[model samples]
Target: MISSKEIKRKPDQDASKHYDSVIDKVLQKLDTVCKEVIDRTNQNNQQENEEARFGQQVKQKPMNEERKEKEENALLLQLAEKDKGRLHLFIKLVDYMTVETLVSINQTSMSMLLEEMKKERKNGLFNTAVNFDVQIFTPDEKEISEHLKCLLDDMIVVMRNTARVISHQSMIGYIKNTKLGELLSEQKENKDCIADVQGIITDSIEYQNIKNEIFEKVTSDFQAAEVYVNTNYMRCKPIYEFLNTWNQGDFENKEHTLDIIKSHVMELKKWLADINFYIKDIAKGILNVDGKKIKNKLQPQVVTKLENFKDYLYKLMQKKANQTLTTLQTYTSNLSKNPQNLKEYAEFIEAIQEAEQNIKGLETAKIEVEAMHSLLKSKFDLNPLKNSDIVMMDDIQAEYLRLTLKIKEAEELCKERKQEMMKKHEAEFIKFITNIQNTTSSVNKGKLILEETQPADALQQLNEIKTRSLDRFKELDKNYQHYAKLMGLSVTTNKDLQELEATYNDRRMLWTHSDKFNKLYEDLQKNIFTTLNVEEIEKEMKSYEIGILKLRQNINNLSKEGRDKVLDQHANRVGNVSQFMPVIQALGNKDLRPRHWKKIFEDLGSAWQPGKTFTLQELIADGVMNKKDKIEEISAKASGEASIEAQIEDIKSKWSQLSFIVNHYREAKDKFIIGSLDDIIAALDDHQLKVQTKLGTRFVAEIRPSC
Candidate 1:
């Protein structure tokens, strides 16, 4: 049987089970999202052929109707021609501003030309209806205006329709062919036919095809190129490839590159997303092919920047390919340090705060425990009981009762003895009692004599006296000891109560810091009080919490870390901020840019026609970057020096002045001994460094085939 002893028993609450359930739920949700993503990918993959087929269908348009209905469509053609003519005039006037500004000026000038024509007509010096609106414009004017209009429209559609098999029908292509044919006999303002007319015609199919082919894979190449520009062309080749490749495989193993692409997108989006991001003149030049000199200077810089950017993007692609052995967890161990994982680290702070708060509450709880101990100790006297007189009270009471009963029985015998003794004494004392006894003795003797006469009365009187005496004595002895025990127990209760009070007072001090207790409580409420299992909560925190907090704090503070840390953050933050990485990359990329890639693809198709092994270097020298890797024979003996060394030497020669100033400043300084010499040395050193560092690297590895 269980003893009826009350004790403080500890309770077992299985918190871990609850926590596990929560974690399982969270992972299940994530799995669901993953499944959905996979399902969507499968769906897209299944429909790719349909998309391609649709593209082919979109290529078929009513070309014959457009050709035959020229007079009815004369306004559009006339406007197209006028636009080309205006483009030439505007190109000369390109040093100025917007199409609005240029067009206003052009319109004013055209008005005067019309006015002159009107005067000539009045003088009978002109022929036919001189309608500027109806008349066809010059080739350059039509080229410029229509190009502008096309840019404003869907450029992809225009490029496709112009170069596609079904719609291989650009006016420029037709006009260029006719122009080439009549070049010897007659020529019209032929300054703009560019790179080479004969070479352009020779590679016309290739050029057209290349122009048709996407130079920029809008998502990958552009995104990568965006990063390339931001990081500079440090890893230019990889950026170029990334920007130039099929982006349908864009996200395959592209975690790092995705971030970079995102960052690139953000920066490039800053330039492109905003209609007002660039200057108006630049925008106007970009919008319309005005061939303006002012724009010409800027174009090469932008293009070069774009090219260098492409290189950087290529490197990023390389980086994406070069996966490290360490897992993501290794990189995300202390997310606070990794700016990339900042988003995930925010919650970790909350968890830590909760833990710390829980610990604080535990301190209070510990104090409460001590209070409970004091309460128990006070209320229950578990302390040893001192030896008491009560221990023998029962035995003594029993013995006393037995003796009383025996004595009562012995009363008769004692009375008989007394009577016998008294009989002898009575005779002798009779005379003395008679002589000495007063009324009481005489009465007692008389009563004894009466009792002798009536023994029952005397016996009754004796029994009553004995019973009352016994009861009185028993009450005194037993009640006192029992009362003492009760008193002792009361004392113990009071003592324990005092102790508990003291303990409570001490515990109360633990609650003195209300802020801490409340905060801890709040943290508990925030972190774990709800569901329970949060093991990976810590893991997730380790992955993303800490970093997020640090970043948020830093952002809030409007402060920055050390330069090295900032640099690291900058690299990491490249993609963390933006989702528009592709646009920037495409805009900045040289290889993938429609202008460059289109030419290359077209030339490749033309040159590498079915049965030919063309001289690749010759094309390369002519600024044609063909899209294939090739190896050519070379003799080590004939080339006594290494290709890399020779190329390096050439690079050194080109950047000789820059290197000289930066490299030999210290040597130059020591050679000077005077005060002015020190200043001269400092100035020269500064100048040299400024020149060299600012000049940047201009080395081309392709030249050496090794550098």
Candidate 2:
């Protein structure tokens, strides 16, 4: 501190040394911290590797176990499926064997009897209760012996295979316990019986020995087989129970194992039940003591005869059942076509009752015949022909209800027919009025008591109208002759007036179609209220108009004169004209009766006016002086002698009367068309076709009964 430069040097040296020491201390602390970080990183990596190895081991063990379990489940399912299939095939084979045994029996006599029955039915001589005894039936000894040997061999093969199948290797370990031992023991007994039967069948050389020994052995073997089947059937229950429980339990995370096994179990149970029933039936059939005793007592030929008789009984039952079904079907078909008839349905019911009584106790010991028996039962129980006594009663009651419905329907149909007849009568009445109006009749009547009258009464009124109308036509002839006589003139008044009117009206009509008249008419129309010299046209027009008017007046006056003359004559003939006046008036409007006549008159009248236009060709075609010619003709006729005119009028009146009567008759005969109901007539034709169709169907359905 005394010397300033020395002190400064000393302090700088100390500071430098102190700074070196601080840097070394900091370096040591950094090394220690880095070393500790490296140790922790190493430790963490080692721990992770160990954890990964342990997790892999854990995962692999479970995966292996799961895979193994899946394989085991698949194997078990496969074996169960195979066993179930085998069992189904075995049952079918057994059934085939049993049927074969029955078929091996002699069937010639039975077949002949059935043929005879068919012939009787075809010839219409078959009676439902007819009976015939057939020759005895028996199996061919040689053929049956051979068949038995083969059958026994097949049965032994099946039993041996079944034993192997139920062993531990095939049964999915289910029979790994005493179950297999039990099955083996029962199988041994069945094998012994089959072997014994086969030995007896093979040793017998003669037909008689073979028949006796083979049948006895067959019976004993069948009994043993049935006993074995029953034992197995009982065993199946336990087996199925175990299988069902096992199928429902989960194993190794496999899917649908329970479902798969349950299906197999169900199939197996059904098979066992069927087999058990079959076995029981077989045992009963084999244990037919009466049959055996009969065979034992009888000679071989007699035994064969008894067998044929049994076969006939079986066939009779079968055919009767078939025939009953066919008969019921026929009755049903008949009922369908003629549902109103109760007889067909009643017969069907009675037939069902007959079948029930006839086939009550009929049965066959043969398995093949049982198949036919099942078919027969199905025919009676199935659709369309299905009926029991109770069902028949129910149907009968239902049919009675249908009859009640039919009664209502019949009443409705009666009312419809009545209404239809009334409609027809009313229509005829209208037509009668139309005919009367069309004729020169004195009286026209169309008013019908349609609602108030019955069909019969209405038809009577229609007939009366027709008859009266026709009678009036006959009266017209007398009136015409009397009027002609009363005229006492050379010309026929009514006839000449009719001719003159027609000619004048026709000429007037021609002017409208005349070019000269049309041009003059146009000019007159144009010159009206003007200074045009249309006098010539006006003069022509005036002449035509005055001529037409004068002609019409003459015609009207002649018509009135003729009518008055007729009335006066009628009064002379009848003593009074007043009573005939009403009849005359009714006939008076004959010209006005036609619906188109009024329109025709109006058109003609309107067209004959002044200033009407026309075409040139129409005038030449109509004849320009037609009215003048007709007037000259009329004058000429008027100039004739009165006697000649009277003669002509008499002939003309007679001709008119003949024409009117002919037309009236023609109109009356065709009333069916105009009077009948359109719908009812159409329905009648359709109903005929439907009846033909029904008859055709009946003929076709009759074939089944013959069959």
Candidate 3:
């Protein structure tokens, strides 16, 4: 039922509404996406800012930690290196004891074999007798058995002592050879490593395992050795006694007596040889011999051989003692004759320690040898040697005492020499310091004078100070070098010298510039006016200008206040001289009249006074000359003279007109009679008179009659 136009409009309107709805939905989607993007960007920016603030600290923390860890590790490694010898010994002992190829015996037997294998191994009497085949037949089996059992017990005791010593040594060696061992030993000295070492010990399974293995092996071997020796010692005594008494029946035979003599001789040789070995060990700081026990076990032939050996040892000790004393004397002589620095003194001290140790060793050897001498005498009633006196410990001790006294004297002398040298050095240093102080004081005084006094006086005083300071500094420098050389040092660039030189150079530069500035100032003062010699003032001014340029070049070297003061003074001088420039230039001008001279004097104001012979020079030097205001007044007056003359004429003409009017009025009144009083009465009624001039017409006077 609708029209066609209405239908067409309805479809178009619907399409338009749909298009607007679609556009609005698309715009909402875009807004949401944009908002999300903006929020993400803001979060990213915040995160980047935080990173920028703390990034350096976060990055450097781990690096610093790593560096510290490396330093600690390096310190521990160095300490471990010092224990290398102990480590090597522990490793060797473990390898030898635990070798798989040595399966013939337990570790205890191996340890005993190791001890016997030493070239300097010692044996008991029973073993010595068996090895040497000494035959002694006695009918008493009990006596032989007892002797054999005692020897076997002695052997067991030696073996047991040996095992105990080796076990202790191995334990100490194993502990000190590891890093943990080093840390424990050096904990007091290196406290910084204590925590690290503790951590390593607590945390490191490998270190714990190593420590356990060492302890277990050493303990096991020692216990096994103790058990083996205890069990076998009694069983071995019977076998030992049987072997020892196999040749017992031959005791009365002549050949048997000869063999016994030979056996005693061989035992004496072995005993003496052992004594010789003990002497060598004592020399190397090892003292393990017991002299009294050996004395109780001696035989007759052995005592005789020992007596002879004693004489030889006495001579040998005496010779060695004399040699040691001679060496000490040589050291003392060297110490006395040479000048020793710290290093040489340290060397001498070390030599003294070594010599003292040697004397101690000889004293010990002497004790052992003297004990043997006493034993021989007591046991066998042996007579003293006919030709040789025994070298007692006292003789060596006396020489040691003399050597110490000489060293003390030498040390005192060295100390005295050092004191004397230090005194001389102190005197020189005081002299040098005093000179520096005096120079500084004088320079400061010069600076004050330059600031407060006149240029002439300041320059004179500064020159004198400069000369004296230069000479003193030269002497001080020479002596400073000498003092440094005496102290065994080089002082080519000493701090005191550098500072003094800088002060001197600064003061000297100031003096030079001050002299130049004063000269220029004086020239300006003196050449302010022309002289009788017409060109003199001009020539001086030219020279002053050149000096001004040169002074300006180095003006910055002065302090700010000083530079300003100099510039101000120069400007004042130039201004004072310029004030007279016009006067000087006009001196040759013949056109100058009295009025021109008056104008110039007026411009000078209080600077030039009457009745004073005025020269441009005198005017410039006048202290009270401060009339800058009159300069423009004088210039204007000088430039406009014709105008002044014209104004004067105009004033004179006005005065003439006033005078004529007065005279004319008086004449006219006198000529009138009483009858012509009408004009006079009119004139009297008008009491004011007017005069005309070039200015204007105005009332000049009032008229009055005497009546």
User: What TM-score do all the candidates reach, one by one?
Assistant: 0.11, 0.11, 0.21
Expressed as tens digits, the lDDT of each residue in 1-707 for candidate 1 is 11112111211124324433543454355345435544554554455555457856655548786456444445544554444444323322321222223224333433453344234121221111111122211122333333323322222221212211111122222223343325512423453322122232224454344333322222232233233323432222233333445242454345443345445534433432222222122111112111133224433444544444444444442332222111122222322231122122223333333433443443343333333333323323223222332233233334334433443443343333433433443353344233222321221232322312333443444344335532343343343333333223121122322332333222222222222323433342354221322343234324332443444443223222322232233224332322222222222232222223334435445442332232323433443322232101112211322333454465556555432223334668556332234545565676567445433433232233433
RMSD of each: 55.1, 42.9, 48.4
Decide which is better by TM-score, 2 or 3. 3
Residue 253, model 3: Cα distance from true site in angstroms: 99
Error of 2 at 159 (Å): 28
Which rank order by lDDT, best down to worst? 3, 2, 1
Q: What is the C-alpha lDDT of each candidate?
A: 0.32, 0.37, 0.44
- Which residue runs of candidate 2 sit more than 4 Å off their true CA positions? 1-144, 147-215, 219-434, 437-707
Model 3 global lDDT (CA atoms, 0 to 1):
0.44
Instruction: Name the lDDT of candidate 1.
Output: 0.32
| Candidate 1 wrongly placed segments (more than 4 Å) | 1-291, 326-707
lDDT (tens digit, per residue) of candidate 2 on 1-707: 12323332333334335434543454345335434444445555565576567765754557688679557655655655455334423433443443333223212222343344234122221111100112111222233334444433443333222212222222222232344345545765676312232333234353234344545654553455345544533343343343335422243234333234335434544543443442221222222111232222222433343334334334543544554444444433433332122233233334333433433222221222334344334422322323452354344344434534444453344333443444443464455445544432221112221123233443455455446654553354344434223222132333432343353343223222232444654443344222334344345555545544454444334342322222222123222322322222222232222222233223334234333334322322344233334333333333332334344456455545532112234457654333335655565576567445544542224222322
